[model samples]
Target: MSADPTLQVSVLLPVYNAGRYLPEALESILAQENICFECVAVDDGSTDDTADILNDFARRDARLRVLSRPNTGIVGALNDGLALCRAPYIARMDADDIARPARLARQAAYLDTHADCVGVGSWVDYLDPEGEHIWTWKMSANPAQIEHDLLEGGIGGLVHPAMMLRADAIRAVGGYQAECKDIEDYDLFLRLLEQGHFSVLPEPLLGYRQHPASINATSNRGARTAIANRLMAEARQQRGLPEKVLTPTPATPESSQLEWIDLALLDGNWRSARKTTCRLFRSVPLKTAPWQALGKLIQAALGKLRIRAGRIRQFVSIF
Candidate 1:
């Protein structure tokens, strides 16, 4: 398809078995304000109702386009979707997250004014599967800091689904690499940063859903880390920096326990979550993850109370 001169952005969404949250994700993109965009949703051979949901939404909205093909994993799906995007800017979105109405408009405007930045992302609110806000994940707006964090595998790196990329810059790098699989976004960001800067808007413009089935929860951490380290090493070599041994942080028993605690929270198993949180506190009082877990539990409890109270108010009003 030829590039649509009237469209300012293209939302590249790749889905596989994402039926449960597909509607909300599509709504978020379709409801975007102050931007002329098209949603190129690639359905990668989903056995579930993902294709049905995409078709239904496409029927309602002419801006939505669906592409169905046999499963070729995320890399293939992303590249195919990228090829079909007809806008100058391509906003990466997942089928399970919510984007604020101004997300695309704000990012597009930033890119329009700042010619140096090849992409821009925003901080995001971490949400549980039920869409309760857990905590706000803040990212650095400084380009240098973003680059440093990406290379060091530290915090503050751009969230893949929260990013808006210059289509040309992305295509110039040969798009997402198949070898980068789970860490394709990281690899792509590194390559793009080499060509131009990346910035993060200081606002939380996306609700990043975290669940037990999410990639971060289920992927092989060891293998993912090795790929990331190698990518960082390559980036440093390209910059002519001296090679340094990139050590992978050993996962402690407490960290593993903390993962279980987080999974329990995502599963809404409050009792198990509380039990694990207490155990972590007793076992590793000085550690930060346990304390963070405790805070999340407290927040979850408060959220539940608020929900229950609202139900009671509605019941009383019915009388």
Candidate 2:
């Protein structure tokens, strides 16, 4: 816990098996200008080279401190980092995401000016695995708009990793609750909003990468709906707030499996493609997964044939 007395912010980055994109994430933070900060990166027992990567960065940058521990999961890693975050303001960063160079400096300035704002987050640019911009999560700028968005539509109204918050306020709310699980950020926001205002900066301060095995892919739609209902119920009963959970039609198991298969194809992971194909074959009532799997299988076979034919042609030419 090498915290600076003059540090205005401490960035809590909890890393798991994120060796692929860890360097880029850290470099982005190191690029920040005129920001007095410390990046408290807790390496939560990554099986990959994540520990080595974090240690290398920590050795180079005095502001970055790496804590290596056994795999206690995300909740444990977050709580550990939060406990050691010794700064007036605290920020969150993800191992697989890149923080904009100006992100830390701007958020720190905002908290300094806005005495009533307990936490502030910026809008995020969503990127595909190839790092191409897909879309943006444009969060509301003011507390009133954010609260309205949360209640009326059951949105947390804030991007989790792109936030800067008051350390004292977050500690007062008891850090992040483990029960929240997949929706921990929303739970934290609900608790913090009870204390003071939570708002978003208009700037795009983070680039979040999407992968097939990501949280967005693995999240249970049913669980999310339950959380939304719970939030709406609490709001109505306690604050007399009018809130509606606009539920989307749930994806069938077959369709969801097919979606994963397609994603696997796009990612060029044939093993995953074949694994998903087997599950789809076993699914009752039959569905699009079977048909999609057949097409993909044929395409792969044809691709292999093409390569073999090309190789034979070259060998014949040499003879």
Candidate 3:
């Protein structure tokens, strides 16, 4: 239930030096159609005008409220925001990302109907630095798919920012823990999966900005890998899964490079995508999926239309 009769979701937007993109992010939330939600934006000790920007927006729109505190990183901001949520559901957002207009309405409707699911996410449209590279990420659409894919070490088959979770399910796990900093969202998703059903929609509901200076960009990779591995192992054990770590199947560099092509296409960098496609074809010409993907990439390059480019990415890979 909401503190206000109109509220159906509480958007948790944590900011830290994201002054440049905060307004567009907030505008996206405020423009949401047929969605009654309150944005609980935490400044998280930003040294830039991030706080002032949030405060200005809050004054203009009652739906958005700003909070400021020390720069304790995303984990602290998430925990604080969770405690302040008045709605039955919580939706995650970032200062630098833009949410789709119907994101909250669709996710809210999904959670309201799917009682067994503790949380749900949607595939996100990834944006490159120049914003020309627009691509969509595919995530597991149901609990069964996620259960099978969770064995992989990266991304964990879920796009964190596009997610909305049940209030009770989040509280059950005591919210985001401090030590799980880099991989907290992944860790919590696993825990929630164990507790109840979780799923994702096929639609690209959020625009995730990719830049070099984001927090995850600078995280200690070794430390994050260690924590993610430990958390996944623990979750598997809790679910009575086998102990052996699953090799992501087909361990070739081409397999890895194919992922790069996906990113290149997403960033709308056809030159990179085309080059990577050629390399993959030369290396693994017999791979049928690569062949299909490469054909699409070539077609995308010839067209040079953003819509076609976006459409081409939908078939980038099966992984």
Model 2: ten consecutive residues of lowest lDDT: 248-257
As a whole number from 0 to 100, the lDDT of residue 267 in candidate 1 is 62
Instruction: Look at candidate 2 and tell me the lDDT of residue 219.
Output: 70
Error of 3 at 108 (Å): 0.4
Candidate 1 residue spans exceeding 4 A from truth: 245-319
> Per-residue lDDT for 224-262 in model 1, tens only?
888888888888888787765455555555565566666
RMSD in order of candidates: 9.3, 10.2, 8.7
Clashes of each: 0, 0, 2
Which candidate has the top score in TM-score? 1
What is residue 245's positional error in candidate 2, in angstroms? 4.6
Give the alpha-carbon lDDT of every model.
0.87, 0.80, 0.78
- Residue 24 lDDT (model 1): 95
lDDT of 2 by residue, 84-113 (tens): 888889999998898998999999999889
Ranking by TM-score: 1, 3, 2
TM-score of 1: 0.81
RMSD of 3: 8.7
lDDT of 3 by residue, 1-319 (tens): 2355567999988888988888889999999989889999998999999988998999999989888999998899989888888888899998788898999999999999999988888988776444434456777686877766765555545777888999878999889989999789888887777568778888989988865455455556667777877877887777688775433233244444555567777666776566656665776789864686676686666777777777778768544
Backbone clashes in model 2: 0
Better of 1 and 2 by lDDT: 1
TM-score of each: 0.81, 0.76, 0.78
Cα lDDT, model 3, residue 183: 83
Query: TM-score: which is higher, 1 or 2?
Result: 1
